[model samples]
Target chain A: MEIRIGHLYPDLLNLYGDRGNIQCMVKRCQWRGIEASVTEYQLEDPIDFSGLDIILLGGGSDREQAIVCEKLKTIREDFKAYVEDMGVVLAVCGGYQLLGHYYDTDQGRIEGLSLADLYTEQGSPRLISNIIIENEDFEMPFVGFENHGGRTYTGDLKPLGKVLFGCGNNGKDKKEGILYRNIVGTYLHGPLLPKNPHLCDYLLKNALMRKYGQAELSPLEDREEKEANLYIRKRFLERQ
Target chain B: MKVRRLMAVWTAKIISAACRLSGRQGVTLAGKIALKIDPGILRDLSSQVREKIFVVCGTNGKTTTNNLLCSAVESEGKKVICNHTGSNMLSGVAAAFVLSAGISGRLDADYACIEIDEASTLRIFPHFKPDYMILTNLFRDQLDRYGEIDLTMKILSQAMAMAPEMKLILNGDDALSAYLAMESKNDFVTYGITEQVFHDQDSREIREGRFCKKCGAKLEYEFYHYSQLGRYRCPSCGFERPPIEYDAKNISMEHGLSFEVEGRSFHADYRGFYNIYNILAAYAGAREAGFALSRFSQVLESFNPQNGRMEQFSIDGTKIILNLAKNPAGFNQNISAVMEDPSEKDLIIVINDNAQDGTDISWLWDVDFERFLDPSVKSVTVSGIRCQDMRLRMKYVDIPSTLVEDVEKAIKDRIQHGCGNLYVLVNYTALYSTRNILAGMQER
Candidate 1:
């Protein structure tokens, strides 16, 4: 079976190499013998979340974000359905800001899917920086950059990872990423997957297992990926 | 070095304060401040920048192109860093990256894309060691600061020297951008308009940049797209818009001109044929950045240029199209777009005599305000601090101007009863204040 990915607002919510996250995912999944297809949804278009295994969102300025915010209003109900049903979703920086309950600024307020246990206040003084994230349960690295004035105050939710490098998800706060069942959220940026290839393999495996029902999917450890995991894990350990 | 830098800081402060009193746009002030604080401050900040750097530079479409490239990368699910604020310089860039780095000084991401100004490019490139440089477009802007085309070209040459390894993503129509293709070591890519917008003519209105550098010969253009950008080849030097890596095909300049790249057409919600090329450059630059066309196309199709650029706002039954026009080339293109609306819109052209607007206001003479004589344009209202200068320039074009004063009043009087759309053209210094005036008018 093939893993289908939904790229939400590819046109409106993209400002950086946000799509690189998808490419990294597609390559990792395909290398592990999983088929993946990404469907992009634009403004005012129908939100068909059918057969979707993953979704990706990215960052932009307040003005750019505002445009997408207008479009997102109409689809809040659709996004809420995905979150409640335990759909696998990934959002970074502005995308992460957008997925939360609210993204507020001086002008007005823009609402998100209210999926994860996160809330953001735009124009706040809690500007976050580059992060090195890890969770105690999973001895792996979660890397990405954060440059936002929006302060994210996490509520009761499972932490995605702890800080291994520069800053954790948010500054001083041990909260970096949010991991809930099949949903993962963080401010980690481009090249995040490249630095954390182990996460890529694991996410791909998760998608593949659901697609093939654990019957036809390849084994978790290939010679190449096993070497890569070892190397990446050592790099994370060195950071510690 | 520190002592001299301290003195330069003082000099920059004095110069900045003097400029503010004189009502100058703060480009020169901030640039001077940067120059004073550290002669090589840009170099210092740039050294700290982790490689895999990307620099977006152009005249009309730099901001849009930079934003588009950033959008494509972000869609790839990467943490991408760029100047969210319009402060696109050494200091602004410093403020952005410094805030993103760790105490150990490691950047958060594997990539950094920056939009650099034309004038500051030379001093700043040594700092931004770009893996890829998207040279978006080159048009005549702030002739006073840039002097003439040749001076700007010289500065670009100096900037290019620092990043010899940078793959140049160029505008094929632009003489300045295409010139960098001569460096064989640097992998260069070009994007330009393929669809014909205007009838090709040798009219005096065409300010082509086709002067032969070899023998002072008036270079012949196969056509003219806006200024001197067209299919040009110096007969002496054999300089031409190279075979494009990603050429825009079937370009149409109607209703926010859209174009196709590599057989895929993308629509931008804004007008002007120039923007099509901007999107094209973004696509080429992003693709070279290892992003799939599918991902890049997805981001650009829904993108819009903000910051009072081709942005529309309504206040009490008046449709106002606010666009930023700083130099002669930009002002001229904006005029052409506004004139094409066919709805007989009211016109308000704001001019600034500020330093950021360029000390040499003489570039006004270069603008083809003669286009204003068309029937679609009902009335011309001139404002900004340099209103009289624009009035003088309009008089040369025989433009009758009974109403000329503050920007708000001009818009209010012209756009009062049954006016469809009021197009406001403000220079750099006047744009922010003009926008503020519009916001204030809405309050009333």
Candidate 2:
């Protein structure tokens, strides 16, 4: 079986090694004897969401984020439909902010896709640190890094996890990310998936199950991933 | 006011001496204490320079370029003040001036060549304006510290506006640096290579300035030397690479580097291609400052790489190379430099997530570690605070690696049993400690 991945604005929204998520996804599938091909959707390219099994939207600089917002606004209806169809989408940092209602910044307000019931406001002294989260759906905790100036509030959507360490969401709610259907949006960008193999496989399994009606994935050796994850989890969680 | 300055200088000197006695470098602590006592310490000391002051700023190569410029100026029979320990922040800049001054809080240097951090320009410029600002190149680095490349540019632009009289010496190959020079409307000179040298096929490189900052249009590159440093032109706005005043031609990388700038042949025993830009920036800055070039070749040949900027050591017939690579672009360049050697070698990578090393270790994935899959790289080992992440990154590329928690042990293990050639790559905070470890082993 094959899985198609759509990477949005690869040229613009690629900050902090964001392409590593695509690499992790592609390599894990290829390791399992499953074919995974990626299609990068540029600023002006036509995005056919129906052909893609998974879609990735990474973070970018403020200037690049504005440019991407203008381009993404044109495809709002198509993206909304894709999200409604239970498409597995992972957005991070600035991309995570773009999936909400609007981001109020020092410069002004920038509109998001409004596909999720969330909003973000620019905050002082950016929330930057190594972050860990605990989710009910996964057996193991997730580990990653977070750096952002926007405080997000998931008004009606369920959070992806609870803040085990570091600041999450607004840093006051003790919540992190927004989970709607199969979509995951968060501010973690240690490419968020390579070290968290369980989370990566979850997205992959969702994509696989939706396409093939079954996802009995044979687990690969995750010793390196587990060690890296545990290294962060043990350091922070133990300290607390 | 004069008494306050004198007290600050004396206290800082005593603190620096105490730090040395205690076996600490005190690279920035002295300056930090001095600034607290007398906030105008930098302004008073820097204004005492007898000749021109040159400031080097950029994401990478700042320390090397600044030190080289200092050497070039010193070769012209002039006394110079410089931060030789790779401390480029505001406090470090202040310390360089303070430590170099006499006990009476007076500076008697003929030239001042200092490397300034790009993000700290706003704070540094208010104290003193440089006669010449050399911008080596701009790339994505330490995103958590400095929000983004555009934000960095904005801060630098504001700093430039504060010092209208300072001229810019820019790297013409970098569109971001060139665009900054143009926007500032300063008298600027560019240095670049006209020919394409690095034929790197890695498409995973994150080119920060692929679009034109002037017109917001995509840039068209004829060929990439490496990571967006090449001949580029914007088809929409007619904005292109400025004419090179210090063009490097007849470039050759075999047996170190050999190149020519404006009919003057120069050679340096440097490893990476990026060093060419560093050397050129120094040469151009010295020339623009009206310094004699007769002793430039001698200066370049005698300048040695210290503090893990490609410093070399030999241990019982085994050769070892140590280098610092803090970001993806820098790491990729270091990898290319390592691959240039065909001899079978063992490699050790030390990654740390300390605040100094940029707490985000995600940039490790952006580096093309897959290139180490070559047969010549006999073995790979990971070490440091974030060795697990490094090991995992290597594993994703199908390169089997040994995980060593301690850096000194990792090096000793390779030197004892592996091939005679070894390469050690480290990040910011790991460089000095790793060098100390290597030095200890070599002495024994």
Candidate 3:
């Protein structure tokens, strides 16, 4: 099955190796003899949300994030429709904050897409560190890095996981990321998917299941991924 | 005040000596301690400089450019105070001054060539204003420490405003650096390679300066040398590369590097193509400071920055090259330098997630490790704290890698059993430790 991945503002919203998520997804699909293609939708490019199996919105610098927030606002209805259709979407860091209600920064309040009932406020001393999360949906824990000044609150959405290590979403709340339908939005950006093969596969499975009604993906050699994931989990999680 | 300055210098000197006696580099620790003793130590010491002070700032090549500028000034029979170690922070800058000062806290140097960390420029500027600020190039480096490139530019712009009299020596090809020069309105001289040298497709993937800093428009590049450092212009607002005063023409990187800048032929036995900018930066800085360039080539010929920057080592008739590859841009350039060698080579990449190394190891994916799948690459070994992440990065590219937990052991294994030609690429925290390991093994 062919999976068309739509990368929103790949040029603007790329920071902290965010493209690695796209690479991880593409590589995983190719390894399983599945055709995967990535169509990068720039700021001016028209995005056909219906043709996409998976959509990735990565993080960017503050200036780039503001520019992308404006572009994302124009396509809010289309994106909301895509999410309602159960299309797989992975938004990270700044992108995750932009998908919410609004991000209150020192400069002023920047409006978000309001796809989810989430909002973020700028916090002092950025919550930056290696983050591990425990999700009941997966057998293994998710491992990634988190660096953000905005502390997000998942208003009514279910959290992706519990914070096993490091600050997640808001340090006050133990909730890490917002998980609504097939959408996964988080602050963990060690591009968040390469080491966490289970999550990568989960997103791929959701995308494939939506397109062809079945996702019997053959298991690929995940020795490296498993080792990398376990290394972080064992390092941070086992200590706690 | 004199007693306090004297105490700070002597205490720092004693601490530095004690650190050496205890077999520790103590590169920045003494500076940290000295600053604690006297907060005004940097200002007091730097104020005593007999001549001009040059400050080098940028993401990469700061240390090398600063050291080279020091050597270039020293070649003209002038005493130069420089932070030889790659310590570019405020404490390091203080240490450079404190350590260089005599026991009486008196600096007798003619020129002070200090490499100030871009993030620490504002802190460093309050102490002493540099006569010339040499910005080698601006690429995304250690995002955790420096925030974003915009933040860094903002910091630098504020720092430059503090010292309006300071001239700028910038890499013209870097649109980010060039734009900063244009915005600052400083008397700046740019040096850039007008020709396209690097054809690596991977280098083009990780450019941080794709958008125009002025108009927020997509930058139009005529050709990219590597990673946004090329002839670029913006369609909107008419922002473009400044006219290069020191244009490096007829560049050749076959045997080291050979290039001509302003009708003067210069060559260095440097490995990476990026060294041309470093050398050019130093040349432009030295010239701008009114230093004689008669012994410039001689300085370049003799300058071998042995602190893990293309530092060479020999063990048991095997040639080993150690270099620091901290960020994606640096690692990509490091990979290109490695690929330049056609000989069969064993590669050991040590990736640490230390606070200094930008705890986020995600930048590894931005580096094109798939290029390591060449026929000449015999074995690839991953080491350090984030070795598993490095191994996983390699695995996605279908390149099999061996994970060695210990960096020294990884180096030892490759030097003993693998091919005689070895290349060790390391990030910030791993550089010194791995260099020490390589040094110890070489002595054995």
Off by over 4 Å in 1: A1-240, B1-51, B99-107, B183-185, B200-202, B415-418, B439-444
- Candidate 2 lDDT for residue B283: 97
TM-score of chain A of each: 0.83, 0.98, 0.97
Per-candidate local distance difference test: 0.66, 0.90, 0.88
lDDT per residue for candidate 1 within B1-444, as digits (tens), equals 655544544455555567657655444445546555666644544455543678887777777777777787778777777765455766666544544544433456656778888777765665557788888766666543553455566677677776788888888777657765564457777777755557856354435344554443445667778776777777776766677668777777666566677888777767776677677877888788777866665576566566677767788888888998876567777877787677877788888767677643545655678778987777788887656546645654657654456776777777675366788888887777777777667777
- Output the better candidate (1/2) by TM-score: 2
lDDT by residue (A1-240, candidate 1, tens digit) is 577888876654543445556655776567666677878775646877756777787765565566777778787787778766666777777788887788778768877667766787755444434455666666555654455667676777777777666554456677776777667777766334544556666666566555455634454443332333344345445766
Chain A alone, model 3, TM-score? 0.97
- Candidate 2 lDDT over A137-185, as tens digits, reads 7889888999999999997688888998999998999899988988999
Candidate with best DockQ: 3
Classify candidate 1 by CAPRI docking class.
Answer: incorrect
Choose 2 or 3, whichever is better by lDDT.
Answer: 2
* Per-model TM-score of chain B: 0.84, 0.97, 0.98
> Each prediction's DockQ?
0.01, 0.80, 0.83
lDDT of 3 at B418: 92
